[model samples]
Target: MLPNKSDSRRRLNATGLSTGDYNKVNTDTTETDGFVNEQWVAPNVEEPIPWKTIAIILVLFVGGTICICCATLDWLADVNQDRSDRIGALTIIGALTIIPGGYYLYILLCILMHRTGYTMDDIRRLG
Candidate 1:
Protein backbone atom coordinates (compact mmCIF):
# COMPACT_ATOMS: atom_id res chain seq x y z
CA MET A 1 0.00 0.00 0.00
CA LEU A 2 1.07 3.55 -0.73
CA PRO A 3 1.82 5.87 2.15
CA ASN A 4 -0.09 9.14 2.52
CA LYS A 5 2.22 12.12 1.87
CA SER A 6 0.59 14.63 4.23
CA ASP A 7 0.39 12.07 7.04
CA SER A 8 4.04 11.13 6.51
CA ARG A 9 5.08 14.79 6.68
CA ARG A 10 3.02 15.32 9.83
CA ARG A 11 4.63 12.23 11.44
CA LEU A 12 8.08 13.50 10.51
CA ASN A 13 7.28 16.88 12.05
CA ALA A 14 6.16 15.17 15.26
CA THR A 15 8.83 12.52 15.97
CA GLY A 16 11.38 12.97 13.18
CA LEU A 17 10.66 9.37 12.27
CA SER A 18 9.45 8.18 8.88
CA THR A 19 6.13 6.37 8.51
CA GLY A 20 7.85 3.37 6.88
CA ASP A 21 9.94 2.83 10.02
CA TYR A 22 6.88 3.22 12.21
CA ASN A 23 5.00 0.59 10.16
CA LYS A 24 7.90 -1.85 10.37
CA VAL A 25 7.76 -1.91 14.17
CA ASN A 26 4.01 -2.71 14.20
CA THR A 27 3.88 -5.29 11.41
CA ASP A 28 3.08 -8.18 13.76
CA THR A 29 0.28 -6.28 15.48
CA THR A 30 -3.38 -6.27 14.37
CA GLU A 31 -3.04 -2.68 13.22
CA THR A 32 -2.08 -2.00 9.59
CA ASP A 33 -0.63 1.30 10.75
CA GLY A 34 -0.32 2.67 14.27
CA PHE A 35 -2.52 5.67 13.45
CA VAL A 36 -5.20 4.54 15.91
CA ASN A 37 -2.73 3.63 18.65
CA GLU A 38 -2.04 6.35 21.18
CA GLN A 39 1.19 4.64 22.23
CA TRP A 40 2.65 4.94 18.73
CA VAL A 41 2.34 8.70 18.66
CA ALA A 42 5.08 10.38 20.66
CA PRO A 43 4.60 13.65 22.50
CA ASN A 44 6.01 16.72 20.81
CA VAL A 45 8.93 18.43 22.46
CA GLU A 46 9.11 22.22 22.42
CA GLU A 47 11.86 23.62 20.27
CA PRO A 48 14.17 25.94 22.14
CA ILE A 49 14.66 29.51 20.95
CA PRO A 50 17.97 30.30 19.27
CA TRP A 51 19.41 32.40 22.10
CA LYS A 52 22.99 32.54 20.85
CA THR A 53 21.85 33.81 17.46
CA ILE A 54 19.70 36.41 19.20
CA ALA A 55 22.64 37.47 21.39
CA ILE A 56 24.80 37.71 18.29
CA ILE A 57 22.20 39.96 16.67
CA LEU A 58 22.31 42.33 19.63
CA VAL A 59 26.11 42.31 19.62
CA LEU A 60 26.18 43.02 15.89
CA PHE A 61 23.82 45.96 16.38
CA VAL A 62 26.08 47.39 19.07
CA GLY A 63 29.19 46.81 16.96
CA GLY A 64 27.56 48.52 13.99
CA THR A 65 26.67 51.48 16.18
CA ILE A 66 30.25 51.72 17.43
CA CYS A 67 31.53 51.53 13.88
CA ILE A 68 29.30 54.43 12.87
CA CYS A 69 30.55 56.41 15.87
CA CYS A 70 34.14 55.72 14.91
CA ALA A 71 33.47 56.82 11.32
CA THR A 72 31.86 60.01 12.58
CA LEU A 73 34.81 60.67 14.90
CA ASP A 74 37.21 60.11 12.00
CA TRP A 75 35.23 62.51 9.85
CA LEU A 76 35.23 65.14 12.61
CA ALA A 77 38.96 64.74 13.10
CA ASP A 78 39.58 65.09 9.38
CA VAL A 79 37.37 68.18 9.01
CA ASN A 80 38.34 70.14 12.12
CA GLN A 81 41.47 68.74 13.80
CA ASP A 82 43.34 67.99 10.52
CA ARG A 83 44.86 64.91 12.26
CA SER A 84 45.83 61.93 10.05
CA ASP A 85 46.34 59.39 12.86
CA ARG A 86 42.75 59.41 14.18
CA ILE A 87 41.27 59.32 10.69
CA GLY A 88 43.46 56.39 9.51
CA ALA A 89 43.06 54.36 12.68
CA LEU A 90 39.30 54.87 13.07
CA THR A 91 38.67 54.31 9.35
CA ILE A 92 40.40 50.93 9.44
CA ILE A 93 38.55 49.90 12.63
CA GLY A 94 35.18 51.03 11.28
CA ALA A 95 35.72 49.14 8.02
CA LEU A 96 36.66 45.94 9.86
CA THR A 97 33.64 46.23 12.19
CA ILE A 98 31.25 46.79 9.27
CA ILE A 99 32.33 43.57 7.47
CA PRO A 100 31.65 41.38 10.52
CA GLY A 101 28.42 43.21 11.32
CA GLY A 102 27.12 42.49 7.83
CA TYR A 103 28.09 38.82 8.18
CA TYR A 104 26.35 38.56 11.56
CA LEU A 105 23.23 40.18 10.17
CA TYR A 106 23.21 37.56 7.43
CA ILE A 107 23.54 34.77 10.02
CA LEU A 108 20.66 36.18 12.07
CA LEU A 109 18.51 36.32 8.96
CA CYS A 110 19.35 32.68 8.19
CA ILE A 111 18.48 31.62 11.75
CA LEU A 112 15.12 33.36 11.59
CA MET A 113 14.40 31.84 8.21
CA HIS A 114 15.22 28.34 9.42
CA ARG A 115 12.77 28.74 12.29
CA THR A 116 10.12 29.48 9.69
CA GLY A 117 10.83 26.14 7.93
CA TYR A 118 13.26 27.31 5.27
CA THR A 119 16.07 24.79 5.14
CA MET A 120 19.61 25.58 3.98
CA ASP A 121 18.87 23.88 0.69
CA ASP A 122 15.74 25.99 0.28
CA ILE A 123 17.72 29.15 1.00
CA ARG A 124 20.42 28.13 -1.45
CA ARG A 125 17.79 27.31 -4.09
CA LEU A 126 16.29 30.77 -3.67
CA GLY A 127 19.70 32.35 -4.21
Candidate 2:
Protein backbone atom coordinates (compact mmCIF):
# COMPACT_ATOMS: atom_id res chain seq x y z
CA MET A 1 0.00 0.00 0.00
CA LEU A 2 1.15 3.61 -0.77
CA PRO A 3 1.60 6.06 2.18
CA ASN A 4 -0.57 9.23 2.27
CA LYS A 5 1.10 12.55 1.14
CA SER A 6 -0.06 14.33 4.34
CA ASP A 7 1.46 11.55 6.50
CA SER A 8 4.85 11.95 4.70
CA ARG A 9 4.69 15.75 5.03
CA ARG A 10 3.89 15.52 8.75
CA ARG A 11 6.82 13.16 9.27
CA LEU A 12 9.16 15.49 7.36
CA ASN A 13 7.99 18.50 9.43
CA ALA A 14 8.49 16.55 12.68
CA THR A 15 12.13 15.87 11.60
CA GLY A 16 12.68 19.68 11.01
CA LEU A 17 12.70 19.26 7.23
CA SER A 18 10.88 21.68 4.91
CA THR A 19 8.98 20.20 1.95
CA GLY A 20 7.60 23.62 0.92
CA ASP A 21 7.73 24.92 -2.68
CA TYR A 22 11.35 25.89 -3.55
CA ASN A 23 10.43 28.12 -6.53
CA LYS A 24 8.79 31.01 -4.60
CA VAL A 25 8.41 34.31 -6.52
CA ASN A 26 9.99 37.50 -5.09
CA THR A 27 7.41 40.37 -5.14
CA ASP A 28 9.38 42.98 -3.11
CA THR A 29 10.67 45.92 -5.19
CA THR A 30 13.59 47.81 -3.58
CA GLU A 31 16.65 49.60 -4.94
CA THR A 32 19.99 48.06 -3.93
CA ASP A 33 22.72 50.27 -2.33
CA GLY A 34 26.35 49.91 -3.42
CA PHE A 35 29.54 51.67 -2.19
CA VAL A 36 33.21 51.81 -3.22
CA ASN A 37 35.99 52.12 -0.63
CA GLU A 38 38.34 54.03 -2.99
CA GLN A 39 37.91 55.72 -6.37
CA TRP A 40 40.36 54.81 -9.14
CA VAL A 41 42.15 57.54 -11.15
CA ALA A 42 44.41 57.33 -14.19
CA PRO A 43 47.99 58.67 -14.10
CA ASN A 44 49.00 61.55 -16.36
CA VAL A 45 51.98 60.86 -18.64
CA GLU A 46 53.32 63.00 -21.54
CA GLU A 47 54.79 61.48 -24.71
CA PRO A 48 58.02 62.96 -26.04
CA ILE A 49 58.37 64.12 -29.65
CA PRO A 50 60.36 61.88 -32.04
CA TRP A 51 62.89 64.33 -33.46
CA LYS A 52 65.14 61.80 -35.21
CA THR A 53 62.29 60.38 -37.24
CA ILE A 54 61.18 63.86 -38.16
CA ALA A 55 64.72 64.72 -39.35
CA ILE A 56 64.86 61.60 -41.52
CA ILE A 57 61.52 62.39 -43.13
CA LEU A 58 62.60 65.96 -43.76
CA VAL A 59 65.83 64.78 -45.39
CA LEU A 60 63.97 62.37 -47.67
CA PHE A 61 61.51 65.02 -48.80
CA VAL A 62 64.27 67.55 -49.53
CA GLY A 63 66.51 65.04 -51.26
CA GLY A 64 63.68 63.74 -53.41
CA THR A 65 62.67 67.28 -54.35
CA ILE A 66 66.25 68.08 -55.39
CA CYS A 67 66.56 64.86 -57.36
CA ILE A 68 63.34 65.51 -59.32
CA CYS A 69 64.32 69.13 -59.99
CA CYS A 70 67.80 68.20 -61.21
CA ALA A 71 66.43 65.42 -63.36
CA THR A 72 63.89 67.76 -64.91
CA LEU A 73 66.52 70.38 -65.64
CA ASP A 74 68.94 67.84 -67.15
CA TRP A 75 66.21 66.32 -69.32
CA LEU A 76 65.15 69.75 -70.61
CA ALA A 77 68.75 70.83 -71.27
CA ASP A 78 69.70 67.73 -73.32
CA VAL A 79 67.77 65.43 -75.71
CA ASN A 80 70.39 62.62 -75.74
CA GLN A 81 68.93 59.08 -75.51
CA ASP A 82 71.32 58.02 -72.69
CA ARG A 83 70.54 61.16 -70.65
CA SER A 84 66.79 60.57 -71.13
CA ASP A 85 67.09 57.07 -69.68
CA ARG A 86 69.12 58.34 -66.69
CA ILE A 87 66.65 61.19 -66.08
CA GLY A 88 63.71 58.75 -66.16
CA ALA A 89 65.44 56.52 -63.58
CA LEU A 90 66.16 59.50 -61.33
CA THR A 91 62.54 60.68 -61.59
CA ILE A 92 61.21 57.25 -60.59
CA ILE A 93 63.56 57.05 -57.58
CA GLY A 94 62.61 60.57 -56.52
CA ALA A 95 58.88 59.73 -56.72
CA LEU A 96 59.33 56.62 -54.61
CA THR A 97 61.18 58.53 -51.91
CA ILE A 98 58.76 61.47 -51.96
CA ILE A 99 55.57 59.38 -51.56
CA PRO A 100 56.17 57.99 -48.03
CA GLY A 101 58.20 61.02 -46.87
CA GLY A 102 55.52 63.44 -47.99
CA TYR A 103 52.75 61.35 -46.40
CA TYR A 104 54.45 61.20 -42.99
CA LEU A 105 55.43 64.86 -43.15
CA TYR A 106 51.80 65.74 -43.80
CA ILE A 107 50.80 63.67 -40.80
CA LEU A 108 53.39 65.44 -38.65
CA LEU A 109 52.07 68.80 -39.79
CA CYS A 110 48.50 67.77 -38.99
CA ILE A 111 49.60 66.69 -35.50
CA LEU A 112 51.36 70.02 -34.91
CA MET A 113 48.25 71.89 -35.99
CA HIS A 114 46.22 69.94 -33.38
CA ARG A 115 43.97 68.38 -36.00
CA THR A 116 41.45 65.77 -34.99
CA GLY A 117 42.35 62.12 -35.81
CA TYR A 118 46.05 62.92 -36.22
CA THR A 119 48.68 61.91 -33.63
CA MET A 120 52.43 61.46 -33.07
CA ASP A 121 51.93 57.70 -33.13
CA ASP A 122 50.97 57.99 -36.81
CA ILE A 123 54.63 58.58 -37.76
CA ARG A 124 56.52 55.27 -37.94
CA ARG A 125 60.18 54.91 -36.92
CA LEU A 126 62.75 54.02 -39.58
CA GLY A 127 65.05 52.23 -37.12
Candidate 3:
Protein backbone atom coordinates (compact mmCIF):
# COMPACT_ATOMS: atom_id res chain seq x y z
CA MET A 1 0.00 0.00 0.00
CA LEU A 2 1.09 3.53 -0.77
CA PRO A 3 1.95 5.67 2.23
CA ASN A 4 0.09 8.94 2.71
CA LYS A 5 1.68 12.29 3.58
CA SER A 6 0.43 12.34 7.19
CA ASP A 7 1.77 8.83 7.88
CA SER A 8 5.20 9.95 6.74
CA ARG A 9 4.90 13.07 8.89
CA ARG A 10 4.01 10.97 11.96
CA ARG A 11 7.01 8.72 11.34
CA LEU A 12 9.28 11.75 11.13
CA ASN A 13 7.87 13.26 14.33
CA ALA A 14 8.42 9.96 16.14
CA THR A 15 12.07 10.22 15.17
CA GLY A 16 12.28 13.79 16.64
CA LEU A 17 12.13 15.29 13.17
CA SER A 18 9.30 17.13 11.47
CA THR A 19 8.53 17.19 7.77
CA GLY A 20 7.10 20.18 5.89
CA ASP A 21 6.80 21.98 9.21
CA TYR A 22 8.66 25.13 10.12
CA ASN A 23 11.12 24.62 12.94
CA LYS A 24 14.29 26.24 14.20
CA VAL A 25 17.66 24.60 13.98
CA ASN A 26 18.71 22.91 17.24
CA THR A 27 22.44 23.53 17.26
CA ASP A 28 22.70 23.03 21.04
CA THR A 29 25.33 20.33 21.37
CA THR A 30 24.50 17.46 23.70
CA GLU A 31 26.98 17.62 26.60
CA THR A 32 27.98 15.38 29.46
CA ASP A 33 30.12 16.43 32.44
CA GLY A 34 31.24 19.59 30.50
CA PHE A 35 32.43 17.41 27.57
CA VAL A 36 30.97 17.99 24.11
CA ASN A 37 29.32 15.00 22.39
CA GLU A 38 30.55 14.38 18.85
CA GLN A 39 28.55 11.31 17.80
CA TRP A 40 25.07 12.75 17.38
CA VAL A 41 24.14 13.68 13.82
CA ALA A 42 20.97 14.77 12.06
CA PRO A 43 19.31 12.35 9.64
CA ASN A 44 19.75 13.09 5.97
CA VAL A 45 16.94 13.99 3.60
CA GLU A 46 16.79 13.00 -0.04
CA GLU A 47 19.05 14.96 -2.36
CA PRO A 48 17.50 17.06 -5.06
CA ILE A 49 18.47 17.09 -8.75
CA PRO A 50 21.47 19.27 -9.45
CA TRP A 51 20.74 22.49 -11.27
CA LYS A 52 23.55 21.96 -13.81
CA THR A 53 22.04 18.81 -15.27
CA ILE A 54 18.63 20.45 -15.50
CA ALA A 55 20.13 23.50 -17.19
CA ILE A 56 22.03 21.37 -19.69
CA ILE A 57 18.97 19.40 -20.79
CA LEU A 58 16.77 22.50 -20.93
CA VAL A 59 19.32 24.42 -22.97
CA LEU A 60 19.83 21.56 -25.41
CA PHE A 61 16.12 21.16 -26.19
CA VAL A 62 15.35 24.87 -26.38
CA GLY A 63 18.49 25.74 -28.34
CA GLY A 64 17.80 22.98 -30.87
CA THR A 65 14.31 24.30 -31.65
CA ILE A 66 15.46 27.91 -31.71
CA CYS A 67 18.18 26.99 -34.16
CA ILE A 68 15.77 25.16 -36.50
CA CYS A 69 13.15 27.94 -36.39
CA CYS A 70 15.66 30.70 -36.99
CA ALA A 71 17.06 28.81 -39.96
CA THR A 72 13.60 28.22 -41.49
CA LEU A 73 11.98 31.59 -40.84
CA ASP A 74 13.35 33.17 -43.98
CA TRP A 75 12.05 30.32 -46.15
CA LEU A 76 8.73 30.36 -44.32
CA ALA A 77 8.32 34.12 -44.81
CA ASP A 78 8.91 33.71 -48.53
CA VAL A 79 6.46 30.83 -48.70
CA ASN A 80 3.79 32.89 -46.99
CA GLN A 81 4.08 35.62 -49.69
CA ASP A 82 3.88 33.19 -52.64
CA ARG A 83 0.74 31.75 -54.30
CA SER A 84 2.24 28.31 -55.13
CA ASP A 85 3.78 27.64 -51.70
CA ARG A 86 3.09 23.89 -51.22
CA ILE A 87 6.60 22.66 -51.98
CA GLY A 88 8.28 25.42 -50.05
CA ALA A 89 6.04 24.99 -47.00
CA LEU A 90 6.46 21.24 -47.00
CA THR A 91 10.24 21.60 -47.14
CA ILE A 92 10.21 24.08 -44.27
CA ILE A 93 7.96 21.77 -42.20
CA GLY A 94 10.31 18.86 -42.75
CA ALA A 95 13.29 20.97 -41.72
CA LEU A 96 11.53 22.10 -38.55
CA THR A 97 10.55 18.53 -37.62
CA ILE A 98 14.14 17.30 -37.84
CA ILE A 99 15.24 19.37 -34.82
CA PRO A 100 12.74 17.83 -32.38
CA GLY A 101 13.17 14.38 -33.91
CA GLY A 102 16.91 14.52 -33.40
CA TYR A 103 16.53 15.70 -29.80
CA TYR A 104 14.14 12.83 -28.99
CA LEU A 105 16.44 10.33 -30.69
CA TYR A 106 19.33 11.45 -28.48
CA ILE A 107 17.14 11.06 -25.37
CA LEU A 108 16.21 7.56 -26.57
CA LEU A 109 19.87 6.70 -27.01
CA CYS A 110 20.68 7.81 -23.44
CA ILE A 111 17.85 5.67 -22.08
CA LEU A 112 18.92 2.65 -24.11
CA MET A 113 22.53 2.99 -22.99
CA HIS A 114 21.41 3.07 -19.37
CA ARG A 115 19.14 -0.02 -19.68
CA THR A 116 21.27 -2.44 -21.74
CA GLY A 117 23.06 -3.82 -18.69
CA TYR A 118 26.28 -3.06 -20.50
CA THR A 119 28.78 -3.57 -17.76
CA MET A 120 32.20 -1.96 -17.92
CA ASP A 121 33.50 -5.31 -19.12
CA ASP A 122 31.04 -5.23 -22.03
CA ILE A 123 32.02 -1.68 -22.97
CA ARG A 124 35.71 -2.55 -22.79
CA ARG A 125 35.16 -5.55 -25.02
CA LEU A 126 33.34 -3.40 -27.60
CA GLY A 127 36.26 -0.99 -27.57
Candidate 4:
Protein backbone atom coordinates (compact mmCIF):
# COMPACT_ATOMS: atom_id res chain seq x y z
CA MET A 1 0.00 0.00 0.00
CA LEU A 2 1.07 3.59 -0.76
CA PRO A 3 1.29 6.30 1.93
CA ASN A 4 -0.96 9.38 1.68
CA LYS A 5 0.56 12.64 0.41
CA SER A 6 -1.66 14.56 2.87
CA ASP A 7 -0.08 12.69 5.81
CA SER A 8 3.42 13.69 4.60
CA ARG A 9 2.25 17.30 4.24
CA ARG A 10 0.79 17.23 7.74
CA ARG A 11 4.08 15.90 9.23
CA LEU A 12 6.12 18.55 7.39
CA ASN A 13 3.72 21.27 8.60
CA ALA A 14 4.19 20.11 12.21
CA THR A 15 7.97 20.61 11.73
CA GLY A 16 7.28 24.07 10.14
CA LEU A 17 9.28 23.33 6.93
CA SER A 18 7.84 23.69 3.44
CA THR A 19 8.15 20.66 1.17
CA GLY A 20 10.64 22.30 -1.27
CA ASP A 21 12.97 23.59 1.51
CA TYR A 22 12.68 20.25 3.31
CA ASN A 23 13.77 18.33 0.23
CA LYS A 24 16.74 20.69 -0.30
CA VAL A 25 17.93 20.25 3.30
CA ASN A 26 17.49 16.48 3.36
CA THR A 27 19.25 15.79 0.00
CA ASP A 28 22.69 15.46 1.59
CA THR A 29 22.54 12.12 3.47
CA THR A 30 26.10 12.41 4.85
CA GLU A 31 25.42 15.44 7.02
CA THR A 32 24.12 14.48 10.48
CA ASP A 33 22.06 16.65 12.86
CA GLY A 34 22.97 19.69 10.68
CA PHE A 35 26.71 19.28 11.38
CA VAL A 36 28.83 18.27 8.38
CA ASN A 37 31.90 16.13 8.98
CA GLU A 38 35.16 17.69 7.79
CA GLN A 39 38.61 16.26 7.13
CA TRP A 40 41.36 17.49 9.45
CA VAL A 41 44.32 18.49 7.25
CA ALA A 42 46.73 20.31 9.51
CA PRO A 43 48.72 18.15 11.92
CA ASN A 44 48.10 18.73 15.64
CA VAL A 45 51.27 16.96 16.78
CA GLU A 46 54.35 18.53 18.37
CA GLU A 47 56.93 19.98 15.98
CA PRO A 48 60.21 18.10 15.57
CA ILE A 49 63.56 19.92 15.61
CA PRO A 50 65.62 19.83 12.42
CA TRP A 51 69.03 19.69 14.05
CA LYS A 52 71.01 18.67 10.96
CA THR A 53 69.46 21.34 8.75
CA ILE A 54 69.96 24.01 11.41
CA ALA A 55 73.61 22.99 11.91
CA ILE A 56 74.26 23.10 8.18
CA ILE A 57 72.67 26.54 7.85
CA LEU A 58 74.67 27.93 10.78
CA VAL A 59 77.92 26.48 9.45
CA LEU A 60 77.25 27.89 6.00
CA PHE A 61 76.49 31.35 7.39
CA VAL A 62 79.68 31.52 9.47
CA GLY A 63 81.90 29.98 6.81
CA GLY A 64 80.51 32.19 4.05
CA THR A 65 80.91 35.35 6.15
CA ILE A 66 84.56 34.54 6.85
CA CYS A 67 85.35 33.66 3.22
CA ILE A 68 83.56 36.76 1.83
CA CYS A 69 85.33 39.07 4.26
CA CYS A 70 88.73 37.59 3.44
CA ALA A 71 88.05 37.81 -0.31
CA THR A 72 86.87 41.43 -0.01
CA LEU A 73 89.99 42.36 1.92
CA ASP A 74 92.26 40.64 -0.59
CA TRP A 75 90.45 42.15 -3.60
CA LEU A 76 90.58 45.69 -2.25
CA ALA A 77 94.16 45.22 -1.06
CA ASP A 78 95.27 44.71 -4.72
CA VAL A 79 93.21 47.61 -6.20
CA ASN A 80 92.09 51.12 -5.09
CA GLN A 81 94.84 52.32 -2.75
CA ASP A 82 92.38 55.02 -1.53
CA ARG A 83 90.30 54.68 1.67
CA SER A 84 87.08 56.33 0.36
CA ASP A 85 86.54 53.89 -2.54
CA ARG A 86 87.10 50.84 -0.29
CA ILE A 87 84.65 52.25 2.25
CA GLY A 88 81.98 52.68 -0.47
CA ALA A 89 82.46 49.09 -1.67
CA LEU A 90 82.35 47.78 1.91
CA THR A 91 79.09 49.66 2.47
CA ILE A 92 77.51 47.96 -0.54
CA ILE A 93 78.68 44.51 0.61
CA GLY A 94 77.41 45.21 4.11
CA ALA A 95 73.95 46.07 2.75
CA LEU A 96 73.86 42.88 0.71
CA THR A 97 75.00 40.80 3.71
CA ILE A 98 72.19 42.17 5.92
CA ILE A 99 69.49 40.13 4.10
CA PRO A 100 71.15 36.74 4.76
CA GLY A 101 72.14 37.84 8.25
CA GLY A 102 68.53 38.74 9.03
CA TYR A 103 67.37 35.34 7.83
CA TYR A 104 69.99 33.62 10.00
CA LEU A 105 68.83 35.64 12.99
CA TYR A 106 65.21 34.64 12.30
CA ILE A 107 66.12 30.95 12.22
CA LEU A 108 68.03 31.32 15.48
CA LEU A 109 65.14 33.16 17.08
CA CYS A 110 62.72 30.36 16.12
CA ILE A 111 65.06 27.81 17.69
CA LEU A 112 65.40 29.92 20.83
CA MET A 113 61.64 30.37 21.13
CA HIS A 114 61.15 26.60 20.86
CA ARG A 115 63.82 26.15 23.52
CA THR A 116 61.97 28.64 25.77
CA GLY A 117 58.79 26.50 25.71
CA TYR A 118 56.91 27.93 22.75
CA THR A 119 54.12 25.49 21.80
CA MET A 120 52.01 24.83 18.71
CA ASP A 121 49.01 26.32 20.49
CA ASP A 122 50.89 29.58 21.00
CA ILE A 123 51.97 29.58 17.35
CA ARG A 124 48.40 28.98 16.15
CA ARG A 125 47.13 31.82 18.33
CA LEU A 126 49.78 34.23 17.06
CA GLY A 127 49.27 33.28 13.43
Best by lDDT: 2
TM per candidate comes to 0.41, 0.64, 0.28, 0.38
lDDT of 2 by residue, 1-127 (tens): 5422222211223435566633322225233223222223344668777788999999889888888998899888886655888799889988988888899889999998999999787888775
Off by over 4 Å in 4: 1-24, 27-38, 79-127
**Reference-based TM-score, model 2:** 0.64
Model 3, residue 11: C-alpha shift (Å): 40
> Model 1, 64: alpha-carbon shift in Å?
3.0
Residue 9 alpha-carbon offset, candidate 3, angstroms: 37
lDDT of 3 by residue, 1-127 (tens): 5432222211124456545674332336232233223323445556543445444545545665655565467555665556335445544665565555455446545644886744222211111
How many steric overlaps does candidate 4 have? 0
Error of 1 at 111 (Å): 4.5
- How many residue pairs clash in all the candidates, one count each? 0, 0, 0, 0
Give one digit per residue, the lDDT tens place, for model 4 in 1-127.
5422222211234566665443333433443343222322455667665566556556555655665675577666755555655555655665566556556556567757766654333321111
Candidate 3 structure lDDT: 0.46
Candidate 2 residue 63 Cα shift, in angstroms, is: 1.0
By TM-score rank, best first, the candidates go 2, 1, 4, 3
Distance (Å) between predicted and true CA of 100, model 4? 6.7
* Alpha-carbon local distance difference test for all models: 0.55, 0.71, 0.46, 0.50
